[model samples]
Target: MKFDVVIGNPPYNKGMDLDFVDLGYKISNKYTVMITPAKWQTTADDYSGCASKNINYKQFREMYVPHMSYVCFYPQSMEVFDIYQIDGNYREY
Candidate 1:
């Protein structure tokens, strides 16, 4: 089946967040809205040791970034989820 939009708050473990965005777009006809760590944007090329190891973030960026319409970032310290804390070393998104 196909969809007009795909929205999700995918798990953050093992780079599943990136997977959701990748697959979400494939199944959606219009948009894929996902809540993923903002860190991915800057550390795109650094997931060589994780589950996203096979993903070429450089090429991913080149393909999908231009189509993005909006993005919002909240500091990891802000505890947006109030479930866990992410390292605040990289604060700018």
Candidate 2:
């Protein structure tokens, strides 16, 4: 299937742990900063990160929203404590 515009209300929380051990995956970089927020509090290791408490937001952003042509969706409430604006440009739920 082909997609053009995508939108959704993403949950707000911490992050997730990624299985990069046997996946043979490579991000091509080390210092990557990613920002993940969900309603439920989850450990950063749940998605993609080096530590269970620290989530690799940069890797998450690259793996999830790596392209600029994609329309990202996100909830407004997540922006409450955030230092940046919640304007829609990339990365949704």
Candidate 3:
């Protein structure tokens, strides 16, 4: 059975990563949209800065997880941003 509406208070725990979830949402529904933590959607080369040089929203949206419908969370502080942004690069390995 398919429901017409769905709802929930999705978690944003420290250990939780929203990238996989965001991609799932996009692939699950062509009309779906969400305001996720800015970092997960777009960040610098080392996963730093306001806007990333490598990572992008399009990449996040490309993840394939059909069960994920929506997301709710807040961005990490600028201090955390500092950790990711080193020497003008986002170094996520």
TM-score of every candidate: 0.74, 0.26, 0.28
Expressed as tens digits, the lDDT of each residue in 1-93 for candidate 2 is 222322222323323333321121234222222223431223333444234243264544456444333333455644544334454234435
CA lDDT of 80 in candidate 2?
47
- Candidate 1 lDDT over 1-93, as tens digits, reads 889989998876656566778888889999889888765677657456446644556656777788799988776535565454645233333
Is 2 or 3 the stronger prediction by lDDT? 3
Cα RMSDs, all models: 5.0, 11.8, 10.6
**Candidate that beats the other on TM-score, 1 or 2, i.e. the better one:** 1
Indicate the TM-score of model 1.
0.74
lDDT of 2 at 22: 10
Indicate the TM-score of model 3. Answer: 0.28
Q: How many clashes does the backbone of model 3 have?
A: 7
